[model samples]
Target: MSVRDLLVLGSASAVPTKARNHNGYLLRWDGHGLLFDPGEGTQRQMTYAGVSATDVTWICVTHFHGDHCLGVPGIVQRIARDGVEHPVDAVFPASGAAYWARLRHASAFRDTGVIRERPVSGERMPLDTGDAPFRLVARRLSHPVEAYGYRLEEPDGVTMLSGELAARGVRGPLVRRLQQDGRVTAPDGRTVTLEECGVTRPGQKVAFVMDTRLCDGVRELADGVDMLVIESTYLDEDAALAAEYGHLTAAQAARVAADAGVRHLVLTHFSERYRAEDEPRFAAEAAKAFDGEITLVHDLDRIAMPRRRTSGGGA
Candidate 1:
């Protein structure tokens, strides 16, 4: 059996509070895992989350921030220590090559497996790893350092109408041709249109944005996405600080989600000053502005995507 999910590894900002860890996440799909922003102590965090280095197929770092990529050396060392034979797909900002090189050789260790670097810089995204269910697109975000946001979209499928097929006398042999050619001529010399028997449904999309302020990239990435996981490093009261540091507050993220048509808004990357008691107020403040489902993330919280439904209440 295969499982697909986004595991919240750590959700704190630059500082790790007692309750919150640093910035880390693991997207698991089809028995493969992609770790994003493995912050400090990610190895132990993974162990606590029941994740292993062997399960990882990719490592994506949004930037070279100490809180985002500091754990890379440890994770790489673990792979080497365990002698993983499989290659690890690595993605980061191309401009951060120096940082990657330093982290790659932060300590003396053997190369565990193949390390393929998939760096991003501009609007366009590189090719997918060719294994995931969705196309991964990267867009530039408003961050002091070089940073980008990623969006994943699955392909749409055609919905067949059983009643239409039966009325048209389409059977096993004829149905295949109708599907392949989008048409079929019956013995009665009647033509059948594909649209008369089938309908097209839109695909699901997911976006991840972090360590950035409200910008066009946020709207573009979150547009029509089923789930939008973004950073909320501060509260609305400290909006000024958020701007100075290139971060978004809870309300700012909510407003963005409201405009982007995101189905679920997951606000994470919280500052260490706030505690669990403050999360409810923060969530409430965000909810006031955005009508979508809002979640103030906690480490190790397993969040499932809402079952497929019409877009924005059927638009």
Candidate 2:
């Protein structure tokens, strides 16, 4: 069985509190594991979550903030120590190349992992994930420092309907021929088209938005996505402070998700100022704007992706 889920390793904004660690998120999609914004103590957090370094295939950094990328050294070293054989791609702002290099080499432990560096420098760019079914896109975000958000989109495909196949009297080689040639001669001497036997399976999408104020890129990344993981570093009461520090309030994040038609909204990267008792306020404010499922993320929390959308059309 294939597994797909979002693993929340750390959920703190500027700094980690006693209960929360820094910002680290692992999105497990099929065979790929994309780690995002790993902050301090992320390695231990991964251990607690039962995620090994070998599981990570990509690392995405929103910016070079200490709270966001401080754990890169440990994670990179751990990857090397564990002898992760596959290539690990690291994506971040092009301007933060210096910071990434420093952290990647910080106390290196006999480097063995193949870490590819792909820096984002434009409005929107696609990262190379080899032959993965989904396309990885990055867009620039509005922040004091250069920041970016990521989106993963799967291509639409066709799903064979068993009932439709049976109705057409298509079986064995005829079904395969219909799929390959778009038309096949059935045993009854009737021609059957691929469209007659299959329904369009719209692909699923997931977006990650962190440490940015409201911007067009944020909505563009979140539009029509199945799940959106975003930063809600502050409450509505601190809206001005949030804007000043390049962060989003729970209400703002919720509004973005609502406008973009996101099926699931995950709000994280909370400030230490909000105590455990105050967590519900964030959810309440977000609920006011977004009617979809909203999750207030905590350390080690896991969220599964929703089912794929079904449609009647071409692949």
Clashes (N, CA, C under 3 Å) per candidate: 0, 0
Give the TM-score comparing model 1 with the true structure, all chains together: 0.91
Per-residue lDDT over 186-210 for candidate 2, one digit per residue giving the tens place of the 0 to 100 score: 7788888988899778888999999
Q: All candidates' lDDT scores?
A: 0.84, 0.92
My TM-score estimates for the predictions, one after another, are: 0.91, 0.95
Per-residue lDDT of model 1, residues 1-315, tens digit only: 767678898988998988888888888766667788999988888999998888887888888899999999998888888777778888899999999999989988777656787888777575576766767788888889988888877777566788998898877877778878999986567888777888776677788898897888889999988889999888889999999999999999999889888889998998887767888878988998899788888899877765665432352
Best-performing candidate as measured by TM-score: 2
Per lDDT, the best of the predicted structures is 2
Error of 2 at 62 (Å): 1.1
Show the lowest summed lDDT stretch of 10 residues, model 2: 306-315
